[model samples]
Target: MSGSWRAGLLAEGVSITVTAKAYRLLRAILMTATEDDKMLSRNPCWIKGADNERTPERPILTLAQVFELADRMADRRFKAMILLTTFASLRWGEVIALRRKDLDLTARTVRVREQLLELEGGEMRLCPPKSRAGKRTISIPSAIIPALADHLKRFVDEAEDSFVFLGKRGAFLRGGNFRREAKWAEALKEMGLTGLHFHDLRHTGNTLAAQSGASLADLKARMGHDSDRAALIYQHATRDADQKIADALSARVKAERKKARKKDH
Candidate 1:
């Protein structure tokens, strides 16, 4: 069945993503039938690499490009959002779910406890992180502290439970609405970053963290990955080491800003 489906999909010119998802669906259904129902002695939906989707490598912004993208946002509120997501390695769900209490500017930390999940009918619900490792305390660079402080003063409510970021109507941020209102596409295009995704900001942060000499365990803890395949060295990762990574990020930003100033002069 798997072999025929693969051949049929290829012959029909189905996209790789659709073919892989279809293969995954078939594999999952067969696995359930074999293991739970015991209707089949073995699952035959086995095709090597058929379920894997080979997506293109996402673009990573340089430190200077990150700042440029953030500055290009017409809404000042989104400036901090872009920087925080890039520097702190926050997922979209986690960033949108952030409450005033989640950030500690004095301590330079951001805590992730929950995510704002969008349901099928456009309903939004606050739920815990996808995995245990996702609920983590991340050290943020001091360079973005001023932007965050400014955003909170102007945009966020004083109540601790109030969301850190909000829509124009003082409600939870919706992804589509945010993109349209914040001029996300315009900002990207103006910065020559067409097709760059918001999630790529987190990828840039993770890459920077690694380049800062963060160990494998440090990456695991920072990224919130729990599967054995994705996790290692968590026990050895220390808060101090994470702080060093944050400091390195801050230094990089400072250096980049100085270079920009020099060029302007």
Candidate 2:
């Protein structure tokens, strides 16, 4: 009915999840609020609207799709950045904050213990990661080692741990840099894929690892999910790998049946 009511329901554990009807109702309420609906002032539902958005069970990118996305981009630095985001599941802020010293080429690991954040007062600061477990060092995949090495050599300028992605000359790369987003969206559109979000790249890494038979405990540690239940979200959310595995089993069964028929002759 109202945003307060919906928010209260959610806050009180009345609904385990958002329903399609609830989503539509929330959307409609937002529209009405924009059109001067005084009854919905300070709507808490608006704050949590993103949680209502649907997410795929498996956000894995196929090997082909990963390579295809690479081939679409000419800027090696941008390509490398996107690849790191997809492969290492580095958050955007962490990527921007990365320094040369943070990477251990010998160990092939990237420590994500810090983040560069622009505070409310508009001062940029490099601080410890948001959560305690976020202070982890994850091993970088060997597939992109060369790409990252090249990126560090060519693109990154040493300004005393300043920034890896400098937007212009002295300005730090802000999230408002629309070129990357527009380019990604256009590329996805050209490839006939829809509903790709930047954060979904992290999901891509999680799903790929899970599909490749990595244990949930390992995935949890890599992804820095604090608990088993949080890790299960990755498993429960990604069903594409399950479908592909099932298809493979069915094909094997069909092949076995064909062999049996042939042997009967």
Candidate 3:
């Protein structure tokens, strides 16, 4: 069955990561059913290290690059959105679902209560976030407060219940529509950044937080991740911070050796 699945995926040009996930899910379900049915003392669907396969790493943007992209955006309204997602570590749905009341400018915090999901037929529905942890309050940076304030004052509706972000026709913002209408491709070209997805902004924020010495618990809370595994990925993804630590250790060892040599002389 595994060989057949692999052949099918290859024929369809599906990613190996996707194949692994599909097989993992199927294996779990089959093993559980077999165990429950007393078919065997121990159900055997285990393929060593198959469940531990890693996907391709996501691209993370620098703080300067994030700001530059925001600045180059054609729509003034989306500029704040870019900053909020990268700095506040908000998912696309969480950011777009924001209402006027969800934002507390005085406190500089955004309450993530819900998310807006767009169905296949362009229908939008308000739903709870992906996980319980996703329903969190994130504090905004002082630097971005002004941008959010300006956005609210200029573009947002007056009613507290009104959506913070809306389409030109006063409808809920759809991801596809926003990408095309906002000239996302053109903006990326100008920034010389290719293959950067919108969700990568959240990854950038989580990685930056990890690099800043935020503990795993802090990262989990800030990113609204339910598992420590997700938080650990951010720490592992911070290559620059890891290199700095290595450099510091080398410098300290060199300094100690120099001091010992001087004393011996």
Candidate 4:
């Protein structure tokens, strides 16, 4: 089972579940083999599936780091992206696929309707957003509205559908250059911060939305998430508000108990 059939079953024609299983078995084999031989330089699991089953942790950024990255960014398009990422929590694909027309300056909202993928070679183009519900609008502050205006005046060109954040050579930004995750890594390092990722910017935005008293429904809309559950995960991820909620609940219960004791007295 660990030979050609296993390799073929883990190949492109294999089901995702089978590939996932292969990854788990492959990990065990490599670990066992490596523990026995410290100098062992290779693992044959590369022939079929991935080395591990775990997803990498997504990163987050602080507000200060977001501001720092925006300030340090030399390219105007890149700077715009940093701000939008921090503010809107839009995925890197969504932002890079954005068109000038996707914004409504009057309403102070941006439509996240599409996502871009970097294919083999240098080709890139917009597909739909990650999910159907991922196509939604999110409000921006007036400050961002003006900033976008300035950006459009200075950077955007061609037509209304032209990419708002065109690379200097005028193409969709490659994911290797960015994708929220990679950019967060770059920005955190640049700003002298540690252990943050671009996806954390989305988390930061979710935390901000929650702190601003946005309802779960509202947060979902703002985040362009696919479900209420996904938005609620932010409420779970954000510790401060949950702590505040716990504190408030304890106060109410304690006060009631104290009042009851006083009445009996």
What C-alpha lDDT values do all the predictions have?
0.82, 0.67, 0.82, 0.69
Q: Which ten residues in a row have the lowest lDDT in candidate 4?
A: 7-16
TM-score of each: 0.70, 0.71, 0.75, 0.68
User: Which residue pairs in candidate 4 collide?
Assistant: 59-197, 59-200, 60-197, 60-200
**Candidate 3 lDDT for residue 161:** 96
Clashing pairs in 3: none
lDDT of 4 at 195: 48
lDDT digits (tens) for residues 158-257 of candidate 1: 9999998888888788766778778987888788776577778887887777767777777778888776443332223335557789999999999999
RMSD of each: 11.7, 7.0, 8.0, 8.3
Q: Which ten residues in a row have the lowest lDDT in candidate 1?
A: 229-238
Assess candidate 3 and give its TM-score to the true structure: 0.75
Q: What is the C-alpha lDDT profile of model 4 across 1-265, one tens digit per residue?
A: 3455454343212433556676677767786786766645665455443534443445555667667777666555667677787788787678778888898789888888888866556577668876777899888877666667888888888588888876667766764344343354455567787645445566677777776777788888888776788677667666665798899999999999999999999
Candidate 3, residues 176-265: lDDT per residue as tens digits?
Answer: 667766788899998888867787888788888888888888999999989998898777767666898899999999999999999999
Evaluate model 1: give its lDDT.
0.82
lDDT of 3 at 146: 91
**Most TM-score-accurate candidate:** 3
